[model samples]
Target: MALDKKTIRLLILEDSQNEAERLVSLFRNAGRATRVHRVTSAEDLEASLGQIWDLLITAPSSAALDPTQAVSAIRRHAKDIPVIRLIEGNDSDAITEALALGAQDAVPQGEDERLVLIADRELANLEERRARRAAEVALREAEKRCQLLLDSSVDAIAYVHDGMHIYANRTYLELFGYDDVEELEGMPMIDLIASCDQVNFKEFLKNYQHQEGSAELVCGGVRADGGNFKARMHFSPAAYDGEPCIQVVIRTESDSAGLEEKLREISSQDLVTGLYNRNRFLEMLEPAVERAVNAGQEASLAYIRIDRFAGLQAELGLADADLLLSDLAQLLRARFGAQQPLARFADDVFTALLPGSPTAGAEGELRALLKQAEAHLFDIGGRTVQLTLSIGLAGLDEKTARAQDVIDRAHRCADEAGDGNALKRYDPADELAAAANRGSVVAMVRQALERNGFRLLFQPIISLRGDTYEHYEVLLRLLNPQGEEVPPTEFLAAAKEAGLAAKIDRWVLLNSIKLLAEHRTKGHNTRLFIHLSSASVQDPGLLPWLSVALKAARLPSDSLVLQLSEPDAIAYLKQAKVLAQGLEELHCKLAISQFGCALNPFSTLKHLNAGFVKVDGSYTQDLGRPENQEALKTLLASLHSQAILTIVPFVESASVLATLWQAGVNYIQGHYLQGPSQSMDYDFSPDE
Candidate 1:
């Protein structure tokens, strides 16, 4: 079984034993393992609460203990159990009351399917909460360990916030001639600098603040005892207690060991290229790979091999070939600079490690370098020779555990390119690899669709304009044999090629309608934003089937907001227009997501009566720039003028909220507020 699909520990607060067994069977039939504990009285409920329970199911009105008493007991115990109250019929009042009294949800009696869906949602949410708690505890422990290391260090280290001393280690305090930490705290760093070099130091600090890397300054220091000394200070960005600050380390010039430092540098450098050699490169790569795996840092590696190097070496003498290699090394150094780690790995192969580079950015840089190398003419002994490069790129992520594995993957990718000035990126699921098992994957997808092995995740779309209705964007995922959820981006293309996209879309629509209907019966006005694939948009029967599904579920047509991608709507404008008109006739709303991506986005909008337009996330991500902000504001103003509600996704932080609010964005959705989950549990009332 997958790590995510653990057995749920269920607590049932029902009077009848048979009903409890039936509920267990329902969950088991739906592919969920359950460890159930039935509670008939208050004592049983209290005892069960003592143990860890993932979900709680109770009767709305029972002879032994009602839901009210059960919920009260749960609160009294200070447990994080989700309660689902079962009502006798579609009793909206009872359901609403149960929810108001702190139940996660309420299900109608005999609706086994509805109950199981709600249970799955609750269990998933419970698991996420538990995982978050565990992560928090681990973070706290790690912080403690780091603090211990900092306190025990011998270096004179201090953390400064806004130029004032916030924290200083014992060594730092002693070096500053201060007896207690209180004396050193809240002191301006400028006060410790000698007056003669203070201006230059201030200028250095100002310049360092705008840069990406660290810098060191040699200046005169003034101690608390009115003594002076020559000191070297290294400044780097750091954070203390979750607030950004600058870390400062001061060492006296007299403590420097010049010979030792020179020897270390000589040992780490390559004689020919004057760059880091293989051993030093591996040493640097180890920590980078560790950071990428443990701290979610982004990094990439590029393996470049000179195409037809052996032929050139054979033509040129050995000395001239060495000269050519040296010339090429200079070019590499000038192109990559000191920011990235570059090394000459073998006779004709070079490696560059790009720290803090995403895969796309790394690819762009490598392609540009490849183009430059192809155009450059290397002069060796008055002989000009031009050569091409075959480069392979691989990203360092959590899946990359060993440094050697990353290099090996990149090397394999380069070899596969076959040395024609080709560039390839290492992908675990490459086309050739996937083609070998395409039949198996297609079978898995078909089986999932038939057996209801797909799961729907809901991400809340919050209203920045005070809309009170609960809104969620529906997302689909497939479960493999191991029960791990696979994102649609990984399998949807194959499904489309297999002619299953339309059928999959129908399954999502039917399930969404069924779930929404059950939820609405609990006296909540909920709306879902469902996405339509290109195949679904072009399918002539989709609109009719959707209408029938809505009517059968007895749901209001307006409650379903059908969404179409901008590209798909542009490609199939006529079909999309017809579908939009048909949905409008059914009293449903239309939304165009990833809008404003085309050369003329408004042209597509003019053809369809879309009520909502979700601007492409790139616009939101680029809001930090003034020009991008102006562009987004202009687009939002135009949409508002046309009476179209605007949604901006990928709002990652609170820093952009005021700007978005000023721009008149109707809704903002991102992980900063809440990521996609199995429940629509966002607290929209507070914003309203």
Candidate 2:
């Protein structure tokens, strides 16, 4: 073994100058440049051992200069350095005794390679120790800085580990009626919350353990005097003293200052429920909408209504009904806390702004909460009443530019789902078509199909990693008799209802392939993404038809990708599996769009062989919010882990590009890149 040009510090115990010179020559030949210090007597060896050295080489000598005695003396000064014993011959007994005395290794004389290898190994180990020691020192300094910040901070902050307080800032000590942090340390976190909220706080922690980002909740805080005050607490995961902990920030109702500011806050608050009034909610929503547009992330508005609320108000007096609403508001606040903004949109109707489109867990929790509320009987001045809730959720997207429009859509959806008291998502196409005459819409779709009035538009999907192939999603638009383009949502439902989806899919496929071939001839390598309706998933002849179409156009089968929505794929799982396999056989790829919406999305993935997954639009549209960003990062990680290329759709803003790149998404498509166009043209230059 030859060492690289690293200079070794060698301390040798030898009586002969010739032997020392020979050892140094061996090391130099092995590429180890060394500074050799030859010491013979015990006093010289002890004095030389004071300096730092990499290795100690002891050549076998007479009784006056014993290698074992030198090894013992070196250990007394610095036990960490490796000691190599040089034996003149094969003396196994002496090697064993030398090792027992602290020799790191034994090498035969003239074996320069063995000595060099031992020295290199000892040097590497020492470097590792130094690095670990430096890291420990840095951690200690970080902890001290954290402590200093805590001591100087005016805001009440505390840290808890294993549900017990481990540390508290000065402001926290003052607010909790304690003199020192030591007094607050080791106290149970529940003890700080009032008796009524203790149970809820415990439950919150259980759910929060799985939550990715920081969360806030309003609870009753108790002071040393046993007085309770409403307080908002924020919990963020943190590390302290090299152990995991939760940092808590507490703000009380009395923390606000100045009468004028307080009055202004009250002006925006609903007196009956203490939630944000309609005007305030609308004001807040304007910025939220702007943020969503600029951040290219999804934010959602929820409209909730009480079923038969008018009858309940009639049965109970107006005052009593108002009391019931107030009680309901309190319940909402208790359950959701400050996770998102809540407002009283109208009489008996509430609206909530979810910054990040609610997760599947959030959706389920709300559904369960609604069920619990429905089953609970309310007592209003001796009168008993039961109410069900209808909730409608509408996510902010490129089309939903106006806050008022989103709120209106959500309200309309909730009213439409009133009979079933269901939770419905706002579907733009469905909302628009509901206002049109159904017979006229059906006739219009049929006429447009017959006239071949449908036009294909392509939207480029940009690749973050600079892939050479060009990709675009083929969108369809139906031109009416007046030459007006009908929104896909409006015409798609009518077509599906009239059993025209299969024909429509065929239309889209044929046009996309024709366009792809023409674009390829112009020297553009392009692939088009086309949607497959549920009807097409069951069309056994679709694959054969595609084979003929590809052969006719002389287009590569892989140029066209078939996309199936998660809901449609799940609704026709067996057929979807067959279609996926068939598409594979045809050398085409299958992509599952609107994925991660199912109760068990990965379960559906297990049944199908999909090459790509487009994460649901709701999750990607709100990348501006910190919580949403974290959620998207986690989802992208899962998709990448499974070796499935992820394509995040609805990339409507430039701000989201960096985040998407960081997440390692394969492709991105949205209005910001370019709306669907008649020509398959998008600037693919790296400069852009």
Candidate 3:
């Protein structure tokens, strides 16, 4: 089952509402949507424990409730909630005490970054525990169902371990002329065989255990009533109660025909919607992938997910949700046709394979299906509910190596398109961009660092409100052997993987500072936004190194605005926060580029003292859409209300100038304004 990635349910033990809000802001800023419940009393903590919570954060100095009491309450209720204690200052004694009393970890009260990091780790561990619990429950239920099926089978079947009978169905007991399975439970299989055939049967069983496939033997059998009969027994490797065993199926001449076919169909089918199950779909996919790779045949696979099905399930309940799912399965089967290989891959996801079809054709079919799903309303127990579909299509060709990889790619694309009722086709270019063949790139990065073969370019961030001060974002490129500049997107990832990201970041900072110091000597009040990778953000030695570098260049810290991408900032929130604090101490500024893409962009700003935020370029590129325009306007309004200076990038044309200006944007940067050049020569004067 997929864990909910959108929201985290938190229980905070604190006396002050302000402090509680501060804690919530930490998670929010880290791109986590949180539903927080703050409790200051033991009664409140006990009541809250009745419900599920992801993590429990308690203040050791709370006046109304002690941390010990909160931990006690959780233990009494047998809750699995992880506890994090907020201690005063850097009290090592208090941290040790809290852990001894059942807390997972303890953080200093003012160290909000540490708290956020600890909370993130605990929440991840909680998710894994929950998933394991769900798996255990499902396994138990499956075992029960398998037992029921085995007991109800007509063929005589029994399971044996080390030649002793462990289990036998009713038919097997009746065939042996025993009234109860208990009577024959401990009997050896050789004892059941007639004396004359015992030696032959022993040799056959020994050989069967040493082989990989099934084996059969026709031997004389002795019943409990001293009667004899000849029967054919099939032996296959099996497991019982988590132990290796052998499964024996005995068939007399009078047994029914077509039993094997019926069992095969039952094993491959899903009892819920009557479609093929995930295992069966995989069985079919493997052969299809082989045909595509070996025979040059073309095929396309699509992963379909029901949008907001979790919310739908919560509203309609599990029973009605299953009914709705059945209705959806029927609709999918009809649309894809009976010959297509389709399966309910997960609770709210489906997979389909179209043989001899290209991605474009498959995408068209999926779009039509999406439209149909959007139009049709599903009725479950007289309640009508409308839903939309998010489909991801991936083509199978000689490039496809593994069936599982294709499924994963399509699944990722579906998740990317989940926000809207849309379809996304898997693009191999994205994979190629982040490919693992980074040996050459790593070598290039190291050589450039050693020889100073790196170059920096600057693009002017033109102010919409006509501010006099000049601003430019620093861009990095590597000079290859042929003097061609290679973009960071091509090699930065490789450098990061090679543990050289921090070195590269430091090199850029040192050179950029030197250039900025020289430029300032020309009487221009300019500031540069230099981007940092996640590795640099997490580096403990970076701040000290940066301080020394800034002083060596004799540049004002404020003139250098360090920037981080939204994803990197969110991923390393704790480190980013610490870095931001350190930069503030040095009078440097922090800016989050590619911002406004998270679930809560402003939440992150609340935790960090960010002076500038560059909105994601998609907002500017998609300005042609009215909804996108309004979205950008609203996002800017939120940022502006917080007193944040907004920089809108990718201003390719003048058409968006009026909209951006009306939205109170502070700066705009793109090719239309001024592309990145070797020299920072753009004029920042007002258009008089």
In model 1, which range of ten residues has the least summed lDDT? 430-439
After TM-score superposition, the amount by which residue 661's alpha carbon in candidate 2 deviates from its true location, in angstroms, is 1.3
Ranking by TM-score: 3, 1, 2
Off by over 4 Å in 3: 1-439
Q: How far is candidate 2 from the true structure (C-alpha RMSD, Å)?
A: 31.9
Q: Residue 379: error of model 3 in Å?
A: 94
Error of 2 at 287 (Å): 69
True-vs-predicted CA distance for residue 186, candidate 1, Å: 4.4
Give me the displacement of residue 281 in model 3, in angstroms. 52
Instruction: Locate the minimum summed-lDDT window of 10 residues in model 2.
Output: 256-265
List model 2 lDDT by residue over 38-86, tens digit each.
8768888766654556677888774446887787675443234677888
Q: Please, what is the whole-model Cα lDDT of each candidate in the order they appear?
A: 0.82, 0.78, 0.83
Question: In what order do the candidates fall by lDDT, top score first?
Answer: 3, 1, 2
Score candidate 2 by TM-score against the native.
0.37
* Most accurate candidate by TM-score: 3
The TM-score that candidate 1 achieves is 0.38
Candidate 1 lDDT by residue in tens digits, 1-688: 3523678888887888898899899988888889999887888787665456678898767888877888878765446789999988886545645665779999999999999888878877876765564455456546756875666455688999878899997667767788788997898898999999989977877777777767898988888989998888999999998888899988764433443553354477777777788977887787787666555576889999999999999999788988888888888988885879999898889999998885657898888888899999888888789999999888776445667878987888888778788888887545223333344566667766645777898999999877878899999987666666666786798889999999889888888888899988988789999999999999988887677667767889999999999999999999999999999999999999999989989999889999999999989876789999999999999999999999999989999999999999999899999998887777777722
Clash number for candidate 2? 5
